[model samples]
Target chain A: MKLYSYWRSSCSWRVRIALNLKGLPYEYVPVHLVKDGGQQNSDAYRAINPMRTVPTLEVTEGGRVHRLAQSMAILEYLEERHPSPALLPAEPFLRARCRMLSEMVNSGIQPLQNLAVLQRIKAELKGDDKAWCAYWIDRGLAAFQEVALETGGTYCLGDTVSFADVFLVPQLYGARRFGVDLQPYPLLTRIEAACANLPAFQAAHADRQPDAVPA
Target chain B: MKLYSYWRSSCSWRVRIALNLKGLPYEYVPVHLVKDGGQQNSDAYRAINPMRTVPTLEVTEGGRVHRLAQSMAILEYLEERHPSPALLPAEPFLRARCRMLSEMVNSGIQPLQNLAVLQRIKAELKGDDKAWCAYWIDRGLAAFQEVALETGGTYCLGDTVSFADVFLVPQLYGARRFGVDLQPYPLLTRIEAACANLPAFQAAHADRQPDAVPA
Candidate 1:
C-alpha cells in the first residue's frame, strides 16, 4: 500500500490518523502539492487520481489499484478494511451522529477555506486575501461552534475517538494556522485538547511528518 | 416514519429519494428554510435536529421516535436498518466506490452551494449573486463531470442506482437552477437522465412534493 499525500494537507492528516489508529503500515509517497505548480495537477498524477486530490491510497490486494478520494470516505474504507480498532460506533444512530459531526467539519467547514477556493476568491473574484479568508474561516467556525456544543463531550462526538475526531483534529489545525480566534469556541478547543493527547492524533500531527517543513 | 423536509433542499431530496428506493412509507413534515428567517432555526426544530439541517427522518418503530440528520448518514442507516432492496453493493471496493462518488457530491459539490452558504456569500459577505453562485457551482460540476465519466456506465455506479445518483440528482437540479451550463458535463447529464427516469427519483423531485413552489 502507498499513500499519495502532502504532509501539511488537512485531508492527508485525516488519513494518516486513521492509518495510525488502525495500526496499519504503508509506504508514504509524498506528492508535494505546492512544489513545481502542484504535483497533483501533473498529467502523471491525474492519471493516478483524476480528481487530482491529495491522499489517494492504492491498495495492492484484490489486484485493484483503488484510487480512494474524500477524507471521510477513505476513513470509512480503512475502518471497514481493518476492523480491529473501530473508528466508528457499531450502533446505528450513534454511527449517524458520528458521521453527522464528521460531515459538519468535512463538508461544512473545510471546503470553503480550502486553498483552491481561497485562491479563486482572490484572483478570479478580486477579493482581498486577509479579509476574505478571515471572513470564511470565521463564518465556518461560528456555525461549527454552535454544533460542537451539542455532541462534544471529550471528543467531537463522545469520549471515544470516532471518525468525527479523525476529521476534526485537522480542521482545528488549519483554523489555528489561519489565526482564527478559537477562544470563542470553547467546546471545539476542549475537544481539540482531548484529541491532542491521543497517540493516534499525536503521530498524525503535520509538524511531526517526515516531509514537514521547519517553522 | 416522518421526514422533516423542505421541497427545494437537496439534503431533504437525498433522504426522500432513499426512502422511495427502500420502499419505506414516510410522512413528509415540511420545514420551510426561507420563510420567517428559516423555520429550521426554531427551538422546536433544533430539538429535532441539533444541526438544524433539512431531511431529519424521525423513525417511529414500535412507537419510539429517533431523530436522524445528515443525508448520507440517514441513507446509510436506511441501507443498514432495512436490508431489503440494498442501496449499496455487498463487495467492499464497489461499496467504497459508491461512497466515494456520493461524497464527491455530498462533501464536495453540495455543501459549497447549499442555501446557507449562498445566503452568507450574498447577504452577509455582500458578494455579487450571479458570480458567487456561478463560481462554486461551476467548480463543483467540473469536478463531478470528471469523476462521473470514470465511474459511470448507464448510472453513477453503473446499472443499479446507488446513493451517488441520489446525491447527484439533487446537485444537478441545483446546478440547473443556478443556470450553470451542463453541456460540458455530458456524463453527468446522461446519468441525470437515467436518474430522472427512475420513479424513485422522479417521485422525490422537489416540484412533486406537497410543499413545492411553482416553477
Candidate 2:
C-alpha cells in the first residue's frame, strides 16, 4: 500500500492515524500542497486522484491497485478491510453516533476551513481568511463539545478509540492552527489530551510527519 | 422510524431517498429551515439534534428511540440495519469509490454551499452568497464529473443505484438551485436524469415533499 499525502493536511493526518491504528504499513508519497503551486494540482497527481486532494490511498488487492480518496471513506474502507482493533462500534446506534460526530467535523468544519476555501476567501471574497477559518472551527468545536460530553468516556464515543476519535484529533490540530480558542471546549480538549497520549495519534501528528516543515 | 426534514435541504433529500430505496417506512416531520430564523435553532429541535441540522432520523431499536443526525451516518445505519437492497457496493474497493463520491459532495461541496455558510458569507464577507455557492458547486461538480465518468454506467457507479446516486441526486438539485451551470457535467446530468426516473429519487425530491412551497 502507498499513501499520497501532504504532511500538514488534516485529511492526510486522519488517514495516517487510521493506518497506524490498524498496524497497516504503507509507503508515504509526499505530494506537497504548498510547494510549486501545489503538486496535487499537477496532471500526474490529478490522474491518481481526480479531486486533486491529498491522502489518496493506493491499496493492492488481487493483483489490482485501487486508489481511493475522501478521508472518511478511506477510513471506512480501512475499517472494512482491516477489522481487528475495530475503529467503529459494533452496535448500530452507537455506530451512528460515532459517524455523526465524524461527519460533524468532516462536513461541518473541515471543508469551510480548508486551504482551498481559505484561498477563495482571500481571492474571491476579499475577506480575512484566518478569521473565516477560526469562525467555523470555533462554531464546530463548540457543537462537537456538546456531543462529546453526551457520548464520551475517554474518547469521542466512550472508552474505545473509534473513527470519531481518529477524525477529531486532526480537526483539533486544524482548529489550533487557525488560532481558534480550545479553552471553551472542555470535553474536546480533554479528549484531545487523551488522544495525544496514544501512540497511533502521536505517530500521525502533522508536525511529526516525514515531510513536515519547521514552523 | 421518523425523520425531521426540511423540504429544500439537500441533506434531507439524501436521507429521504435512502429510506425510500431501502423500502423503509418513515414518518416525515418537517422542520422549516427558513421560517422565523430557522425552526432547527429552536430549543426543542436542538434537544433532538444539537447540530440543529436537517434530516435527523429517529429510530426505535430495542425500545430505545435513537435520534441520529448527519445524513451519511443515518444512511449507513439504515444500510446496516436493513442489509437487503444494499446502498453500498458489495466489493470493498467499489464501496470505497461510492463512498468517496458521497463524501466529495457531503464535505467538499454541500457544506460550502449550505444555508448557514451562505448566511455567514453574506453577513461576514459581505459577498454575494449565490455566487459563493455557485463557485464551490461548480468546482466540486466539475471534479465529481471527472470521477463519475471514470466509474459510471447508467448511474453514478453502474447499472445499480447505490448510495452514491442517492447522494448525487440531491447535490445536483442543490447545484441547479444555486444557479450553477450543469452544462459542463454531462455524466452528472446523465446520472441525475437516470436517478430522476427512479421512484425513490422522485419521492424524495424537494418539490414533492409535504412542506414544499410552489416555485
Candidate 3:
C-alpha cells in the first residue's frame, strides 16, 4: 500500500495511526500542502483524489489497486480487511459511541478549521484565522469532553483504543495550533496523554512522518 | 424510538431517511432550529444532545433509552440493530465505496455549509452567507459527482440505496437551498431524482416533517 500524505494534515495523521495500529506497512508519498500553490491542487494529484485532499491510500492486493480517499473510510476499510486488533468495539452501541466521537472531530471540528477554510477566511472575509479556528475548536472540545466523560477510560471508548482515538490525537494537535486552551478539557487532555504512550500513536505523530519539516 | 428533528436540517433529514429505509417507526420531537433563539441550543435540548444539534435519535430498547447524536452514528446504530434491509453492501470493497461517498457529503459538504457556520461567516466577517454556502457546496458537489460517476447507477454505489444515497439526498436539498446551480452535475441530480422517487426518501423530505411551516 502507498499513502499520499502531508505532515500536518489531521486527516492524513488519522489514517497513519490506523495503518500503524493494524501493523500494515505502507510507502509514504508526500504531497506537500504548502509548496507551489499546493501540490494537492495539481492536475496529477487531482486525478488521484477529486477531493484534492491528503491521505489517499493506494492499496494493491491480488494484482489490483484500490485508491481510497477519506480517512474514516480508509480506517473502516483497514478494519474490514484486517479484523484483528479491531479499531471498533464488537457491540453495536459501543461501536456507535466510538463513531460518534470520531465524527465529532471529523465533521464537527476538522472541517471548520481546515487549512483551506482558514485561508479562505483570511483572504476573502478578512477574518482572524486563528481566532476563527479557536472558536470552533473550543465549541467542539466542550462537546467532546461531555461525550468522553461518559465513554472514555484510558481511551475514548473505555480500555480499548478505537477510531475515536485515531481522530482525537490529531485534533488535539490542531486545537493547540489554533491556541485553544486545553485546560478546560480534562478527559480530552488525559486521553491524549494516554494515547501518546502507545507506540502506534507515537509513530504516527506529525514530527515523525517522512514529510516533516525541520524546526 | 424518538427523533429530535428540525424541518430543514440536512443532518436531521439524513437520519429521517435512514429510519424510513429500515422501516423503523419513531416519534418526531420537533426541536426548531430557528424558533425562539434556536430550540436546539436550549438547556433542555442540550441535556439530550450536548452538541446542541438536531436529529438526536433516542432509541428505547429493553427499558433503556440510548440517545445517539451525529446522524451517521445513528444510521450505523440502526443498521446494526435492524440488519435485514442492509444500508451497506456485503463486499468490503463495495461497502468502503459506499462509505467513502457518504463521508464526502457528511464531512465534506454538510459541515462547511451548516447554519452555524454561515452565521459565523456573517457575524464575524461581514460575508454573504448564501454565497459562502454556495461556494463550498459547489466544491463538494463537484467532488461528489466525480465519485458518483464511478460508482453510481440508479442510486449512488451501483443501484443499492446505500448510505451514499442516504447522505446524498439531504445534501442536494441543502445545495439547492443555497442557490447552487445543480445543472453542472448531471449524475448528482439524476441520483437525487431517482432517490426522491423512493417512498422512503419521500417520507423523509423536509417538507413532510411535522415541524415544516407551509410557505
Candidate 4:
C-alpha cells in the first residue's frame, strides 16, 4: 500500500496510526501541504486523489491498483480488508457509539479547524487568525471532551485502542498547534496519554514522520 | 419510534430519509431549531441528546432512546438496528466508497456552509452574507459534483438508494437555498432528480414537513 501523506496533516496522521496498529507495511509518499503553494493541488497528486487531499491509499497486488480517499473511510477500509486487530466493536450499538465518537471528532471538530478554513478566515475576512483558530478549536475540543468523559476509560471507547482513539490523537495534535490549551479536558488528556504510550500512535506522531519539519 | 425533528435541518432530513428508505414507521416530534432561542439547547432536549443537536431518534419502545448525534451516525445506527432494504452495501470497499461520498459532503462541504458559521462570518468578520454563502456552498457542491461523477449513476452510488443519497438530498437542498447553480454538474443534478422522485426523499424534504416556516 502507498499512502499519500503530509507530516503535519491530522487526517494523514490518523491513517498512519491505523496502519501501524494493524502492523501493515506501507510506503509513504509525502505531499507538502504548505510548501510551494501546496503540493496537493499539483497535477500529479490530484490524479491520485481528485479530492486533492493528503492520504489517498493505493492498495496494490501484482499491478492491480485501488485508489481510496478520506481518512475515516480509509481507516474503516483497513479494518475490513485486514481484520486481525479490530478497530470497531462487534455489537451494533457499541459499534455505533465508537463511530459516533470518531465522527464527532472527524467531522464535527476537525473540519471547522482545517487549514483551508483557517486560511479563508485570515485572508478573506481579515479576521484575527489567532482568535479564529482558538475559538473553533476550543469549541470543538469542548464538544469532544464531553463525550470522551462519558464513554472513555483508558481509550476514547474503552480499554482497547479503537478507531476513535486513532481520530482523537490527530485532533489533539492539530489543536495544540494553534495553542488551544488542553488543560480543561481531563479525560481527553488521559486518553491522549494512553494513546501516546502505544507504539502505533507513537510512530505516527508528526514529529516522528520521515517528512516532519525541524523546529 | 419517534424522531425529534425540524423541517429545515439537514441532519433531521437525513434521518427522515433513512426511516422512509427502510420502510419503518416513526412519529415525527417537531423540535423547532430557531423557536425560543433554539429548543435543542434546552435542558429537556439535552437530557435526551446531550449534544443538543437536531435529529435525535427516540425509540418509543421501553423509552430506551439512543441519543445519536451527527447525521451520519444516526443513519448508520438505523442501518444496524434495521438491516432490510439496506442503505449500505455488503462489500467493504463499496461501503467505504459510499461512506466517502457521503462524508465529502457531510464533513467537507456542509460544515463551512452551516447556519452558525454563516452567522459568525456575518457578525464577527462583517462579511457580505450573500457572498459568503455563495462562495462556500458553490465550492462544496462543485467538489461533490466532480467526485459524484465517478461512482454515480441514477443514485449517488448506483441504482440502489444508499446512505450517500440520504446525505446528498439534504445537502443539495441547503445548497439550493443559497442559489447554488446545479446545471453545471450534470451527474449531481441527475442524481438529485432521481432522489427527489422517490417518496422517501420527497416526504423528507423541507417544504413537506409541518415545522417548515411559511414562505
Candidate topping DockQ: 2
Error of 4 at A136 (Å): 1.8
Clashing pairs in 3: none
Which scores higher on DockQ, 2 or 4? 2
In what order do the candidates fall by lDDT, top score first?
Answer: 2, 3, 4, 1
Error of 1 at A100 (Å): 0.6
DockQ of each: 0.58, 0.91, 0.84, 0.68
Instruction: Compare candidates 1 and 2 on lDDT and give the better one.
Output: 2
User: What's the ranking of the predictions by DockQ, best on top?
Assistant: 2, 3, 4, 1
- lDDT per residue (tens digit) for residues B1-215 in model 3: 89999989989999989888999898999998878889988999989999999879987778988888998888888888899699999988788888898999999889988878888899878999999889889999899899888878998888888999999888888888889999999998898899988999999999999989846
Question: Tens digit of lDDT per residue, candidate 3, span A41-114?
Answer: 99999999999999899987789888899998888899889998999999888898898989999999999988
Runs in model 2 lying further than 4 Å from the true structure: none
Clashes of 4: 0
Off by over 4 Å in 3: none
The whole-model C-alpha lDDT of candidate 1 against the native structure comes to: 0.81
lDDT values for all models = 0.81, 0.90, 0.90, 0.82
RMSD of each: 2.2, 1.0, 1.0, 1.7
Q: How does candidate 4 score on lDDT?
A: 0.82
What DockQ class does candidate 4 belong to?
A: medium
